[model samples]
Target: MEKSVSKKAEQTLKKARVKYPIGVKLVVIITVLLLVSLGTITFLVSAMVSSDVRITAEDNNFTVNRRSATEAENKLNTVRSNVFLLLDMLNAAGSSAALSRQASAFFFERNQDIAAVVIPGSLELVNTRFFVSNEIETTLITLFLQNEAAAVRRAVAGEPLLINAAPVFGVPVIAMLYPWQESGYEQAVVTFFSSEDLTESFGSGANSSFMVNDQGDVLVHADYNLVRAGANMANTPIVQAMQESGDRNLQLLYTDQEGNRFFSAFRKISIGDAAVITSIEYNIVFEGIAATTRRNIFLTAAVLFAAILFIWFFSKTISSPVRVLAAAAGQIEQGNFEINLKAKTQDELGLLTDSFVNMSRGLAERERLKDTFGRFINKDIAEKAMKGELTLGGETKHVTIFFSDIRSFTAISEKLEPHEIVGFLNDYMTRMVRCVNDTNGVVDKFIGDAVMAVWGAPISAGSPMADALNCVRSALMMRAALLEFNEGRGGEKKPIIKIGCGINTGDVVAGQIGSSERMEYTVIGDAVNLASRTEALNKPLGTDILITENTYNLIKDYLIVEEMPSVTVKGKEKPVRMFAVVNIPDANDIPGAGAKGPRTLAEVRNLLGIKAPDMNKVDTDAEEQKYKIQES
Candidate 1:
């Protein structure tokens, strides 16, 4: 299933590719790449800017909240000083009236914001005149009496105690104890100040300031409802950041339960184990950064648009010439070698265009010459010649020469018109040449009614035995090919054809052997002459294929042949043994497959339609061990 989907996608892409011209495709590809690169850069820059803006805002908020907390601490210290002074007066006078007057002066006149002044352990409040509500006065008096030991411990330790026990029935205030121990009396001078004093220390804006006790309960809040409800914020992000930050101050960005983002700072108030928290909504805090980012995105988009436009035009300049060259190449592939392209500029693309034109012209000329050369020589040889390997020279090398001629060609031509004779000859020669060419034999030339080929001069079959066997195989296939050709002719009007092939393996001087202006690559040696003679002798021997004794020796183990009468033709002083090949039997089908012994050649004569010769007169014993044939 995956493979099918992938293949379908590939096909769709291929179709889409075909719909666009090279220039358009190039422009699209270049533009897309540029856009991706610029987009990535912009995104990274925006992210970095946003991060820096957040960090800077957090630091400023931390500073602001810290200052406010310090101010609140200073106010609490001032209240402590006033209470200490009142305690000194009470210890000096040791009278209830003096204590009452001192408390009244301190709470009502000296510091009107002081909510209450209490003398703990005396079970009497020194003064509650400043208490706006009776419940506040009663709550403070009760709390001080119950926690007298804690206040005394603070006095002994020289540290003031701050309690946010309750702001006296919803009236927020900070209470502090000044322990008094004068030899016999042990009491704490408790002072209460309104919580609004601390909350008002932080100036108002989009931000809200609040105070939370050690238990995370709201002690004083700009939002009064929170103070009334005593909301716990220990699990809030601001409190979590405060706990995690080992320092007394922390600033961080957090999101609330409603998913509104905020930037908050927390500072431990100097008066007690309370923290002052300032929180501002994220949108308000990062308004300027958001505006800047918007402008940056607009600028980035404009730059990217300009870049893509430039890339598109630039790519067109490059791909335009390439498109023309590609079209010219397509024409060339279809054999239309006439290309007319002009260079438009003096750049690499222009140079490439010029080079392509020259190359195409050169190829067209080469192809013309190649076709003409192929008509005179083999196609493979023509190719090698064009590559400069077919130089004017000669070299002596061992080769297997093959010669095949139609028997009774004159009689056959007399039976048809000149055109029919030409057609018939062409058809015959075409088939014969194919056999030779397929077996790696180079067809050297064609006589009036025969073809001469060789296997080891221009190129070799890599070994002498291979060349000889290839020559024999080509001969056998040519005979089989004739039967196929006759079968294709509808049988009635087709002229029956018979060809005789002769093969010989020997050394020959092979190379170009004519004037420089008109040279022909041909062989001139006794072997070439002998192979022709052997072909002629095929008529007298009544055989379709005959090989000299030397060729026979090389292919004896692979072919089944019968010895023929040894003959001495022109230019040879001794008779050369020849053989008529009958068939190539599968070695596994032959009896005594691995045995090495001399076998009489007559054993295969019946299969080849040749009469057995008298064995005693033929020197059959001399044909054993390894066969050798002289020039004939």
Candidate 2:
């Protein structure tokens, strides 16, 4: 009997050893899956966050750039308008063959604005005089005639002109002149522009502003030091391209003498026989944007990192029960069915694990079922459903959809290697999403560098237009942030990230859209399409933020509106009227008038030249000829 008992005990021990191996294998599988899932989730979250940061920086940079360009254009336009007005006065006064010298004298004496009037006949300045009776006129005449004959000829042949000539005492003289042809007198209206006007028109900052002639000669620059040093900006890419292409709105990014990268936008201003090239550095215009972006990014990153740490700790605490269950299962598999899993907490996982212990009578079968359930349904999903996100159907709601696609993402991708491209996209997308999220917009998906988002759905306050406006404002803010990021990158590879945002307010089918196997909470409707098309239209319209007519109609009262021409969208019969959100007017300003000034010289010339002169003859031809010959 003792011998039989010994043999049974030995057999039981052998069976226990086999069961222990199986239990150990199951535990290892669970542990590995947990680590991998955690690692993958962490990596994905980190990658997503990092991408968001980069995109936010890029978008911010682009928006700020756009704003800076607009502001510069507006300011220059204002100055140009003033110049045009002066030209008109000159043109009107100069058109009289009888009053040519009298008009010059009137321009010099009556108007404190006009500094001097230099009338050039063919190639040489026949009459050069200033408002002040000073020695500067002799030096200015000499400088104007020196190597400027070709320019004068071009100006005489119906080309308006502006020339920058350095005079004595290092004063830069900007010559604004146009061809003047009447019955008796055939000449050009040459007006010497005051340096003070140039400085006031183009504000002083790190970024310098200049006006160049069609020949690429620096006609008028804010930087007197550079002008005095004989810097020939005419040969620069900015001037060369303008002369070559005659593109009125020319933009170029180049490194300066100090190796600092600068973005310049050039506009060709033709007075009559001369072209004025206006160029301003982008850096000075968007300096505030750069500072704002840096501050926001640093703050956001700090908060996000802290939140991630909190999430990791919270996840560990929540997952502690699963870890315990895994250990218990390993023990039970070693033929230790006598073990008690006393974690009788009300949580579904704990209850399930407790049930598993009680069903140890058929442990292998129970284990098989548990394994199958774990594989078919992710443990997290199962637990979450039990706690509730698996409710069937979501409510219909009004949502504002925003879609943004980079203008030349495909070209950018082609330029970069596959890995670099991926990195770039990742960085760009991440920041864009973050900006949306920061502004209470939910990111729905990413199609390469494009981002789709929605407001007033999932989580909203019923103000779809307001939400959309917030999103756009945030996007603009993000552009300023990116400049600092680029600065850190040695200012190379300045990312030209342009975004178009369209916001439409309408009801949509909002719910989890997918099979039970895979699902995403999203919205779908015509409004989505409208929003997408609005964003796409940004490039064509030369705008950064664009909103649908519906959206504009809703927010017109609160937000300033600039009615854009109707545009034909992809699936629409009639074109849509989009409105751009202008910067909020100052408290002390009128809605349409922040700053007002005189019309430009070009405009003045256009107004005067619109009606050709019916000149009456004067006997001053002989006197003028005598004066011209004497001056020559």
Candidate 3:
């Protein structure tokens, strides 16, 4: 028994010579896919959030700068217009000096930011001027006239000069003066007021606002100390951008001198040489987004870690069962069919493990039976039985039946020794059986030197038409295989042989026949009987193959055949038509061959060394009475 098992093992290994290289497993593939999916999602979300925050910051900067600039310009315009109104009131000549004094007091009351307003007399009184403030009018006017000499000269020379800042006043002061000469005398009005309110309503909270002169001097700023110091901001990015830009307003991102980045905006203001600048730090702008991104990254990392761990453990559940099954299969290969596997979970892996256990037990029983009875069953029947698919009784099937016999087996057997005859029959049966198996037909049995086969019963080759085609194809294959088998043969021990095949297509009952203890899988019906009778006619007709009317009808277009006289069977009243097989046109798709056979019966008889029967002898009635041949 051990020797038998070992020999079987060696045979199985020899048959399983083909091997393929292993590839990457599911765990790694799934892990890589998961990482890519999470990473892509995280990156896209972070990018969108960052973009939105940056845009919002820029918009805020632009809005703050524009609003603040408008407020400052409105304030300055109000102050300048009020000063002009005072000049106009003073220039009204029909009014008395008392009226002019009263009008100046009213102007000073209405324009409280005006520090002191000076109105020059007409050309007759060039040295004479009216004062809007009684207390500091003379001192402030003298200081501004002395400190800003160029400005004073410009105002007197008929040029309206506006000075936003006068350092001599030691306050936020806006000084404006204009020429008022009706006669050609050097006379003008000068007024000074605080610029404190210009920026009072601008900068607050995270956004800071400031104004820079064309020279880049910090004129009005949220920081009072910077304004007082007259900070030079010529090199600042916002200041430089404002000076260079042709736009009325602009916004961008920049890093300040301190290397702190900000979202900043610049707006050109109406105030002399000044523009409003608003800025908010980049960190403050996108801090929320940054924080969110950090959280997302952390979460993604956690999810990735968890997914990897899960995939690792999950793959174990599958691979472990597979490994156990593989080990069990190795034992089975060594003829040890006993298996012990306990499925732990309720997943597919568990189901597979359970199925494997059942399969091992079933294989063990089959092994025991085989040891008792030997390799005793047909291959097809054994396979179906092992798979628990075989059942007793029979089924009605549309099938193609085939029968083949050696031309002169009895006379050859008489000449040869018993052992030699057995050897010869075995060789011939092996080749013929291969043709049947190759065409997917089941060999029903071998009787003496004759073989019977069936297609479309154990399993149909799709339909009756297909079975008929395969049946004819198998006969053609036998023709080729026989010629090859007889390549170098002759004399008594190795006689050159000829075979005749008959095919018929019709309904039959096909199944495992006889009692369960001693059974055979075969087909039985009139189709099988007709096929046997047809094969017997081949020798007398000088044909190598023949088919009944039923099969000829099925594959008439595919085969090149000649019609023969109809035959009268024992039971049938009608004469059944028969045809002699010649050649199948281009039978490609058959393994190792095609319709490379005799195209004419003369060639077939010549190849097989058979003389054609003389049809003019007139023995049709006698042939019918003796061999069931009839001319229709």
Candidate 4:
């Protein structure tokens, strides 16, 4: 039952461990910490990189936009200055068609950006449309210029307009008119310059450039389709913001109508109310940083996996030994001192395992010593001997000596095989020896089918009287034990057996007695011889337990006895008294026997199936050798 409960507790401990293994906890704890630390570091790095890259990208966009704007403005400025030079030369050569033709040719030569030049008729200048191409080019330019006749009127009305887009010409064009003051007549020259040159300077990429007028109308853009479609960007957030902003150039991040975010930089030029603008999608601007963040995530995951694997193996190295030690502890708890364990490492766990092994060995040795000596000596005496506290030489002790022999043992042995004889002795002696040991008697030796034991030798029950009482109690106990041993034993190999116990109390020499190589603990003197002789007399006397007067005197009050006829010792003239023990009165003799113990000699004789002895017909020579019985 104790083993079962221990097994249940171990199972409970196993169930509790299902979720809380040291290896798993180590992996989880370390993984979480790695995740937190790596995640925070990745976030911080990405944030910092994004911030720096965004600023750098914005600055780059602004720088490129401003340069493009300046290039376009300078081109337009050259056209304005060359047109003014032509007007001055024509004014100097008044009324000369040759000079007028020469001036127009000179202006067109200095600026090939000019597709056509228009001179409105006035007091000093002719309404001349100078075309530089064949009929096809002339017709195409003429057709596109006619659409801007309204802008000419606006220039004549002193508004002085610059229309930066004229995709009507099938290419990028800039048409501008400055108020002309010539000979006090209201007239103007409209020069058509190719802004296509600016398109060559632009690049199409994630970052793109385009020009827009004050009205936010796109012109000279890298995408010629927007110019062709006349796409108006007037409501564009960045363009509107640029228009409102007092700065000449600025960078901003804004979302378009499609919810697409953009990084945009705008620069206003000095000509034609035009501005150069560049923009890139926000995701494209930070794609590199996004890639870096993903790599950081993957790296952190890899490190976590590696660390978990390492911790698992490492924790197993530690916890496995602990598990083995726990199992060893259970084995020890069950009284199995022999253990199989080894220290596989040189760390603290290995040290603990080594210590456990030593402790188990010590216990096994102690148990072996108890087994070797305890059958022939008291356990306390064996312990004292192991600790070097027992005296090796003889000492006189007032002790009770007990001897019991099986009756008709030679006849019983002849009826059984040799193995059966051993088994029979072992079975019978086991019960009888328990009776002796239970009452603090040490078995001194076994002589064939007999047993010798001593009380109050080497160790005592405080006094001779105490030891004597214990010896007598053991004799009664053996009677009951032998009765148990004989039940259902009628077979040849397992014949019914009876034993007689003789107990005597006297001063005897007791100690370890033998040669240096072979030692035995025993008692000697007249008491032991008398006890042996008294045991042999049991068959003739019809008794199972007999005690000398010396033993009977110390335990008279505790036992019921019948005084037997005197027996004269072999060498003594006087006779020694003997008694037949029937019961121990209140000794708790057997289960359901009376509280006063078995009270009558008749009851004992009946229990043991002992027939009455006829001393008149009993004259044994073996008994005569030991004593002379004087029958009453």
Q: Number of the top candidate by lDDT?
A: 4
Q: Given candidate 3, what's the lDDT at residue 618?
A: 38
Off by over 4 Å in 1: 1-313, 339-355, 384-388, 414-420, 487-495, 552-558, 563-577, 584-632
Model 2 TM-score relative to the real fold? 0.32
Which ten contiguous residues of candidate 4 have the minimum total lDDT? 123-132
Most TM-score-accurate candidate: 3
lDDT of 4 by residue, 1-632 (tens): 99999999998655444333445666677777677757766675756666789888888787777777788788778878877887788879888989888887777666766766665554222212323341225555455447777777767777655665455655666667756766686666777767677877865556788888777877778877888677789899999988899998888899999999998988887765678888888999889888777777777777767776877787787889999999999999998999999978655676678789989999988888787877655687788788877655888889999988888889989988888788878888888888888988888888888889999977788988899988887877777677677777787777788888888888898877887676677899988888888887788889888999999888898778898888886655678898998876577745324365657777778878899888887774644467678867
Q: What's the CA error at residue 231 for candidate 2, in Å?
A: 99
lDDT of each: 0.72, 0.56, 0.75, 0.77
Better of 1 and 2 by TM-score: 1
lDDT of 4 at 49: 63
> In candidate 2, how many Å is residue 351 off?
16
The candidate 1 region of ten consecutive residues with least summed lDDT is: 589-598
Q: Write the per-residue lDDT of candidate 2 for residues 1-632, one digit (tens) a residue.
A: 99999999999655434222434544665565555555555554444454454344444444443444345334434444553454556557655755555554554454444454456543222223443433454555656655677766766686766666554324655666566665566566565545555544443444345655556665455666765665667667666766787555556666766766555556555342223333344454445555655655665566556656755675563478778777777777785555566644444554556567767646755456555754443333344444566555677787778787876767666666778778777776666666675677777777767778777766675577676566655544444343333444522243544455566667788776788777766688877877876776555445556677777766666555566666555556666677654433221132221123112323322322222222232122333321110111
Candidate 1 lDDT tens digits, 1-632 = 99999999999665444233545656676677667766766675666567777777777777778777777767777877776776666666666786656555654577777766666546344335555444444555575446556655664455656666453446666667655666776556667667776666664766677777665777777766666665778899888777667788877778999999988988886555677888878997779877767776777787778777877787787778889989999999998788999978655676677778989999899899999989989887788878978778889989999998887778777767888878888888888898898889999999989899999878888899988988887886776687676665633246666677888989999988888788888887999888988887665566778899988888799887777778766667778888987655543322222133114444433323345433444332233412223322
**Clashes per candidate (backbone, < 3 Å):** 0, 32, 0, 1
Question: What does the lDDT read for residue 76 in candidate 2?
Answer: 38
